[model samples]
Target chain A: MKKLWISLTYLVFIVLLIIPLIRIFSGSWAEGWEGFVEALTRPQSLHALWMTTIIVVSVTLLNTIFGVMLALYLVRATWLGKRLKQLLNSLVDLPFAVSPVIGGLMIVLILGPNTIMGVFFEDIGFKVVYALPGMILATLFVTFPLMVREVMPVLQEIGTQQEEAASTLGAYSWYTFWKVTWPSIRWGVIYGVVLTVARSMGEFGAVLVVSGNIMNKTQTATTLVYQDVENFNVLAANSVALVLAAVSVGLLLLMEWAKKRKGH
Target chain B: MHIEVSNLNKHFGDFHAVRDVSFTIEKGRLIGLLGPSGGGKTSILRMLAGLESPTSGDIVFHGKKVNELPPQERGIGFVFQNYALFKHMTVYDNIAFGLKVKKQSKDQIRERVMSLVELTGLKGFEHRYPHQLSGGQRQRVAFARALAPEPQLLLLDEPFAAIDAKIRHELRTWLKDMIERLGITSIFVTHDQDEAIEVADEIMIINKGRLEQKGSPWDIYKNPQTQFVASFIGESTIVEDVSKLKGFEDASVWPGTKALIRPEYIEVGKRSEFRIASATEPGRVKHIHFRGSEWMVEVTVGDTTLITYRSLEKEVLQPGDEVSVLVHRAYLFNDNDSWIMENKLKEDPMPIHI
Candidate 1:
């Protein structure tokens, strides 16, 4: 019975993931690669790719640095600040709790053109609600948890022993941070960065409200897929979804490779 | 290297883990930081190594105060109990870590590491991970890594306690010889009195975060400075209200007192001198076992237990038999039950091995 259950589970898994991917793959070529080629070569598609690359890189880098510092702060801080740190730790996961559409609405309410905060932001010469800036903000908001969640657990497991040991060994704080602390968390950081990149790449609803879907400025692949689907362009939509799927697979492979390297 | 520790105190929150620990070590002696778990022996060692800061006091090494100096600059070698070898590195790289940290040249690091590998009998096992080696070999690798820094002082915390019995026995002798060859001042911490005696030139027995006694191994074993040390070091029988014997110094004796005497000093045979009143009340011998060279006889003396080791050639004293025990070599303590003093060697007591 146990064996039968395991076999049935594997069957279900294959039917769900592999079968759908096969359908997408078949549909992808049914249009003779013309849809994929057209999608890739079009100005809108290139702009979307450019926007995604810029947003993912910026969000991932900023999130990783801030997240690492947050983890280090929470673990090392003492006294009253530790309690505040504990509260902040739980608060960092707030993005996961809210619905993506609610997340979009929240960003719109706070940063849209009609709000006082939005007016102030615009007066400061930063266009947050309907531009590349808002897209980056939404991407950063949804994906900020990845890097901290990754590096924090590794830091907790390794404990402060090696850091203390290095300090006593005469490595100054920065040297110790770079050599000992960083090396131990390097694989986890990379894994987290890959997760952030993937998450930022596929971010849609929140970004959609803020990006205004500018054709050559702020439409990401996820938003492109959504817009193309709405327009009843099934081939273009399927091709964009296929590209997103391919990116997810590539990032997932990177994660697995990181895990293997960590094991070594 | 000479080390002077003054009023070193360490606390973890409300707990006074190490309190006012002060000791001085003459150069080139193997000192044992002897204590049970949680006695803060490791904490003191860490403070000396600059791994942990003392809440108070200072450690002076070679006439330079190093309480604030970082561990890497302390010029002290540390061997962790579980042998904290770098799992990612082979034996060769593990030993060479300190040198690499110091930015030594490649050839120099190789030569130093290889020589240590040879010295530690790890010549053929240089490429093995710490997990791949035997426990004893892993311990040796830890020692080799420690020595690679060419440290003036070395520290080992329960270094042999993790190995299997046979391996422990083998490594203890080899390690002692190796340390002696290096002639580096060292301190080894262990709970087992036997291990401390085997390796330490001087032993400091600690209890309840306080130093119970500190002396040469023979001195501490022969005449422990405290009842705790006496009981901890050797198997002994404590009898109180014996009505203080005439000549012994029971330091706090007003009318009567107790005595701490080891089992080996007691002779169980027909001695015409003293009356063996409690011992002769015939109870069944109950259990008799040959202990390789001698017979371990458990004779009940009234409501108490007395252990006696008799010769193998003697007629087996079985259960339900009569026996006599004569207490001779004894270390008497005061009424408050703390250690006062110990008897001197009138004559080298026979088979007086502790």
Candidate 2:
């Protein structure tokens, strides 16, 4: 009886998940692969793909480094006061609760045209909103928590004994970290970066609120999909959406592999 | 290197860990920091290893102050209670890590690591990861890894505390042999007095962050200088009130002084055979325990019970048998807890009031 119930629940979950994925794939190729190829080949769509890749990759790289350092400081270093550390730890989860659009609006409120930061940037001949930087900032704000949350528990689990052992063995601080500490936390970093990449790739609400949806420039893959559907280019929209879904699935698979590799 | 810990004190917030402790250790001797749990033995070891800073004292090494030195620059090898072997690395890599960090050539690192693995009895398991090895094997790996850089001083924090009980004695003997062969100045912390007595060239007994005594195993065992050391270092019967002893009233020992008599020093026989010449006390044998070559007889006298070891050659003593105990040697400590002297009860009891 238990086995039958478990199998029924598993079937329902798989069916619920797989039906949309099948519809997505077949709907994107409804007009045949030729139309799919042609829509993807359009210059604007091509530029959006490139822009999305650039933003996601840069965000993943920067967030991976920052996440590991922040997790290390939180777990191992004692530079902050107790209350400040707790506050910072709490703030690490801000992106989790806040909507992506509101995060983008927050950036705008601080760096938009009327604000002091916006005026300073404008005087310096730099643009934050309606630019590639604005989209990147939105993606960064949405994906910042992925890496830190993944690495913090792993760092706490490994503890400082190995690091202390390394130091007592005459290893300098950096050498001890790179040698003794990094190997233990490498899987966690990989898992974090993978999540960060996937989240940044699919981030839409924040990028839409900040980048102004400029074509051939600030328009990312997600925004381009929206623009294609608005202009009645259904095939173009489906093609870009399918590609984004595939990339996200690929990242999800990588994350699963990393999680398995770091099993208890 | 010779090490000196002078007036070393450490405070963690409001808790005092190590008090005003001073000791000088000679070079190339294996010393044991023996104490009860939470007695600050480990803290003193950490202070010497530079893992912790003394709040108000200096640690001098070879006549130079080392209080400001980091653990790495202090050149000390430390083995933690958990071993703390690198879980991700094989035995070879873990042992070779320090030499590699020192930028030694590949061949030199391999040579040094192989020699250490051989020395530590880890030659057959160099490729095994820490998690893959047994507790004893992992402990040896931790020791090898710590010794790879040729540290001047070696500190072990309860190195055998985590191992199986059956293997503890084996490791203790092996470690004593290894340390003596290397001739390194080493100090290890342990709460087990037996391990300290068997393994260390000298034992420093600590209690409540205070130094109770420091002497050789023979000296400390035979003549513990304080009540705490005497009671802690050996299995002895402590008579709280010396006035209760049958002949102790005339020995110039005061009312509240405590006398420690080792089980081997107390002779047991039938009550009728006990003469009044010696300090003979009558008691009922409450229990009899077989200790291989000897019988451990617990006798209840007055309001206290004392453990005495009798040879197997004697007649078997039952639980309800009445027996008299003769004290051949007893060390008396005053109410102030300092050693007074060793008293040998004689056949002719004389009045000695001084």
Among the numbered candidates, top lDDT falls to 2
For B75-143, candidate 2 gives per-residue lDDT tens digits of: 899999998888889999999988998999999998999999889988789899888899999899999
lDDT of 1 by residue, B1-354 (tens): 999988989887788888888889999899998988999998898888887789999899999999888887888888887776656568887787778788999999999999998898888999888789988888888888888878899988788878899889889889889888888999988988898898888999888778888899899988787778888897787766433322233434545556676778665554342353432223335467788999877766555566668787766777666656554556656646544333332234453467
Model 2, A184-223: lDDT tens digits are 8889889898888888998999999899888998899999
Per-residue lDDT of candidate 1, residues A1-264 (tens digit): 999999999999999999888877776666787767886767887778788888988998899899888877777655446568889889889888876666777888998999999999999998888888777888888987888888888888777755654443445678677766787788889988888988888888788887888777778877887877888877777777788789899999998999887654
In order, candidate lDDTs are 0.78, 0.87
Compared to the true structure, candidate 1 yields what TM-score?
0.86
Summing lDDT over every window of 10 consecutive residues in candidate 2 chain B, give the lowest-scoring window.
Answer: B339-348
* For every candidate, C-alpha RMSD to the true structure in Å: 4.8, 3.1
Candidate 1: TM-score, chain B only: 0.87
Give me the overall lDDT of model 1.
0.78
The candidate that achieves the highest TM-score relative to the unseen native structure: 2
